[model samples]
Target: MKFASLDPASVSPRRSRRLWPWLLLSPLLLIAIAATLAVQSRPLVEPVDGGLKPEEIQSTKDFLRRNDPRRLQASPHRLLRIEERQLNLMLMQLAQRYGQGRGAAQIQLQAGTARLQASLQMPALGVWLNLEARLSQTLALPQVEELRLGHLPLPAWLAEAALRRGLGHLALSVQAQRAGELVESLRFNPQELLLGYHWQADSLDHVLGAFWTPDEQERAQAYNRRLVEISAAYPPGSSVSLALLMPPIFELARARSERPDADPVAENRAALLTLALFSTGQRWSKLLPSARAWPQPLPRMVTLAGRDDFPQHFLVSAVLALEGSGPLADAIGVYKEVADSRGGSGFSFNDIAADRAGTRFGLLAKDAPRSLQALMRVGLHELDFMPGVADLPEFLSAEAFQQRYGGIDAPAYRQMMAEIEARIAALPLLQQANVPRL
Candidate 1:
């Protein structure tokens, strides 16, 4: 320590020499910092108006998490769990990417409406462009009102004048226009945004028909009429013909299989049985009056007595016939029981069992090829008393039903039956029963 001369003069020159580069770079560093802040603040939507309660925020978050339309299986009207800040940040990033320069927007929840304010930052010129608007919708027609740009009001008169001059038509999309037309009303509450639509019996048919050419529409109408006739051929308000019911089940199965988000096998099984009950308009709860079909626990493995009279004896028998004894099976039993109680009934358990040799479903269950038997069983299940379960277009009217599933004679119906028959012939039935049926 004594050997080294600690002279201030000597150290000061060395320190100053080392600091020169940083001192020279200080202006660029300050500029960078200023630029970053300016970029972040440009067209910023600050959380200034705090009206939402803690509970409201929590509930809204929960609702959004539970119900996102992006989730295919989710309900149509759902809240998004995303926070306003994050959403604004995303919008800003998107705007920046698109050369809009830090376009930040924010939402403020108010009574029956939301206020949105956004800004665009011109970092080069150190200037900010601001926009303010309120969201107010009529029916499903969402309109952005009170739109202002840089303190200048965007008047309704301007829009009306533009429309009058044919400068631009309302700036509303075709989809928005159609939604406004279709939706009867719209509601926004603390809970969620709800759009109410009135669906007439033939509304869907008419909507679908709109997509078809005149010749195609005529053909579809004729085909649909024929299918309705076939569906209506079932005995009025009694037993469902599983043979006739097979076509819809087949269509449902195909559709279910196409859904990537679903368990197709399980859905197909449940849908088949549910549709069968719908076809006959029968409820499952009453099928077994002595047994508590619903509001009771189902066994993990429901052991069916090795009796051919089984499935025929119970509308849910078809579901019970599935290969596995798991949650799906248990759900089927419970749903079937509930469905029987909720829907229109045609036959008692005993009546269906005894008529095994007489009715089409009974005969199919009794003596048809094992594949067909399994198909019938797998396709049929009890319906649950849930919204939108039995709203099959065909079931709305005999005419509609006939137009969709026109029995064994209709080409689609015939094709489905033939395909199921071929599948049964090709594949062996899964062995589900532990005991042999008598």
Candidate 2:
């Protein structure tokens, strides 16, 4: 877990600000809380059947393979196959995450129907809320045959309505709903399930906007717009280095930081987001649709170590870490390189190095924003954050990749990864105070 230091001066005032909202909404809040308590008053199903078994968990490589980045640009329709064991393991992982180690989830698939069951522990009330949803036919076009909350079976529509209402208050529900709409097909078998989806980019900015205030959104947009201007100054098709933009952008952040009541972390996050996206050849409109009206970012071959692909791997992973989790970003990075080995550019450890660098930089910007700001106030050299690409292996075919390094869990792969990690740790940028090696 992580923690934030509390400010004594702000505690009372923050509590004071919070009182009005709670007081005004007390009636609705109480009603909702009461309804929830009534529905989950007792355990309808056995709670915590089999604890999460480490032996039953899927291999980490299998987990990593799910984040393949090639899916981002693949055809609209795609299929994913999972067996019963994998599904249950995935559920166990999810329950551990959302159920705070006190819950369990299991799915039993057979014939044309599936049964999904879950039990969650209520805080301070020691009660287990059990639910089971029965679905017939396809998960893509889901048909809810039965819905049970605790021991009470309810009409499908009633449960659907209740769920819709409950989902409105969840912070990530919008993203989840948007993502679910992309499912294209589903087939359930006695032993396995086949799930297919359309690959469409969901605007993460829109998803994250749920947490940002209007002012924060506008501030991020301003940085994106500045990047457009920065791109315009360079010639199209020529090489553009992120070095050209980082210092200037962070200087803007520093200026904003000097203003009263400004949050240095948020400022630094916005600047990093802008730089990473623009340097990667991505359209700003993808970040925010209003960016469509902004000047076009001129085309340039963003290069590091004289290779155009390095920038894409680096900046993309950086921004992923900035907005998401570091482990997730790292796994996705590996997936990209693995996908490349399959008849694309082949695998390249150099690119992996770049991806690692980006992840660390993103983490630094996220966890040590004030320290990042102080460094940016001075200047940035390419070598500080992204040092020289070592003489690592590159451009190996799939067969060669497997023969030489085996899989990601192989000792050879891990040794090379360790070398890459050490290189990143030695960078002058990460060497600075408060900067961490991811």
Candidate 3:
């Protein structure tokens, strides 16, 4: 029952050998610790000077600054005046050929000088052109209607001549009108149109000859060709024809005629830069898929009061909205009511219904799949997605409208909704809420 006392000398050799192993391992552990300390103590490299030097950085900045769209300003006044002169010349000849009594019918020429004043400050050249075109359209209606109706019974050759002259006049008139509106809407004013007329003799000559000289024609044609090229380059719903036409016309008119700093190449380059920037800004939402997923809520719902003539009228109240507010909400309500009143026919919310609340829907509603295909085609070819329900509300025919709006054929709504969902899934977590749930 007595406790046994153990002596250090009697310990087993195996146990003593284990202690030796620990002693031996101490140096290795110390070495590992030393290595870690050495590693941690080492100085971190300054991120290998990846950035440019101050001077180089500044030089690049300077290059970008020099090439900025804002720096490429041309006198909108001069451009407008030139446009006006060209338009007047074309109109006079049209009146001579197509007026009711040959040149006897009074030819009235009015330019939207006020509108042109506003165009001077437009940030984008394309918008300016649209404004000009709108102005011209308003002005040419009277002359165009006169020629079209009056010249109907003339001989074929003479009729053709009249038609061409009338068309030219109408084109110029519309272009000028649109330009003026665009300038006014954007609130741009360059005050360049107020200068002394260096091209006074040229203006007189243009008025005398209904057509541009070959040289002038070539310049205008080249500009138009560029516009065609640009329009073709963008995807469906991404280009505006009027926008493409403005910059070059401005540059060409300024270059061809005597003007200060008559550098055509520089002017052209500048015009191109301005156009690109403006177009990018305007179509940025359409061009970038990421942009579409962001939902902007409208402040309030819109309601349009019923009108006797326009039972189905609607308008775009906001360019991009999360919730409708002000006029936009009212517009949306009007559009929805129009759509709902049709009772499933192919007519859009903008189309007039035979009955105020009829049950007759269009072909598109009958065959959604077919309608979607037609709508896609319309989106691709006609409106280019830039047009809302308000613009070009009618299609090729009522049938076409039925097919486009109500058909809903290819890429079925469900499929499109799914795709949109997938796209939303891929977005950053914060942006997911913006995607509309179908």
Candidate 4:
């Protein structure tokens, strides 16, 4: 009989931080745990029945084929489609690779419960931990209330405590809700977990394009209010990268905009614009050299009363980082230093945040030509290629540069950005490249 080994005491603090999030995010892991714990004291019978249906076999195969990134090898068949004896053997092989000893595990669907049976190995205790868990479909989180280790039953208090702790760590409300919905849609038989998720073709565009819903409308406004409160939290010379992921409210706004029958409120529409700007700016920042200079995006708690805005302030302070003795670095550094010197006030950057606050629906971006040129110099350092000064004469013309890459009004702008990002991704790291041009 195969046994899965688990030694919780060996988990280090650093590993715990990384592993807990991954484990807690996946409901499948929870089910696997429940299935492992529940198989205790259950009779081990030969495979009498329980194999995935033909259609389920096809869908599972298709899911793996699409999701697996490895192109050089042929995709393997789903485990649930195979015989129990073969499945356990495969699990044993996987267990060895993952530092877990082989474990005998099986799932069966009966009387509206997805039951999992397993003989787990507790290496620390040197004991066989047998478990049987019954997973029932409920509106809230699925409970693995019934659990046993060997002939002894696990305390309900212990299981509930663990469940509460696991769920508490998932802070993304929107993602958690989606995960719950995914669990709810699962159809399980002893053989397999049937995913009834209908893939939406437009979902990616709807998210990236800044969609919003009524609830999201409120959230977007809240985001701006938060921005107003926290914009001054850092000092005049300190600046941070706008690294925050697009919030759910923006996605809702995009959906609202696409619907012919629905009209989005002014607040959400404004939020959508701000988020889109923020997302685009953050993306463009990556096309340049120094990525770590972009700190983790400020949290919603600080910016939005839990409602957050896309940052509009060009990071004048960060441009100072480009200064160094190297010819390319010094050129950019001197440009930014000179520009900041000309501004007189320590706060040389424009305060466009307030423009977003009241009824006015707009923001003023600080115009720092020297800072822009400095950043381009950094980008050039990353390339082995130098577009000869004669090949791109507009590189010297300020008006030409602005006309070519300044406006973000047209859909073609997005295509251009995509191309720029692709080109950036193809280049080597700045430090790795030996080009001597500034």
Question: Each model's TM-score, in the order given?
Answer: 0.25, 0.61, 0.16, 0.26
Q: Name the top TM-score candidate.
A: 2
lDDT of 4 by residue, 1-438 (tens): 999786888878898899887877799886677655544433332221222222333344454565532432332221223333444444432222222222456666543466656654555555455655667755434457576555556675576664455345432344444434433244444554443332244332333223334455444445444443444465554443332322333344445445665434443434434444343334212322222233333432212211122133222212211111122111222233223333432111112111111111111111222222222332233122110111212112333323554423346534543443333333342223322212
Q: Write the per-residue lDDT of candidate 2 for residues 143-259, one digit (tens) a residue.
A: 778988775677887866766764664444665676566667777889688887766454344443345557767787778767767778877667866666677788788788888
Look at candidate 2 and give me any clashing residue pairs.
Answer: none
- The window of 10 residues in a row where model 4 has the poorest summed lDDT is 356-365
Question: What TM-score, to 2 decimals, does candidate 4 have?
Answer: 0.26
User: What C-alpha lDDT, on a 0 to 100 scale, does residue 193 get in candidate 2?
Assistant: 82
Better of 1 and 2 by TM-score: 2
Top model by lDDT, which number? 2
Cα lDDT tens digits, model 1, 32-136, are 765544343345453213222223334444555664334435333332334455444444433332332244566665446766666666667776766667777
lDDT of candidate model 4 versus the reference: 0.36
Q: Assess each prediction's global lDDT (C-alpha) against the native.
A: 0.40, 0.72, 0.31, 0.36
- Writing each residue's lDDT as its tens digit, candidate 3 over 198-307 gives 23323323332333334433443444344445455556544244223333434343444345534343333233332332333332223222323433222211122222
Worst 10 residues of 1 by lDDT: 383-392
Cα lDDT of model 1 overall? 0.40
Decoy 2 TM-score against native:
0.61
Off by over 4 Å in 4: 1-63, 66-99, 102-104, 138-145, 155-160, 163-178, 190-192, 198-438
lDDT, candidate 2, residue 409? 73
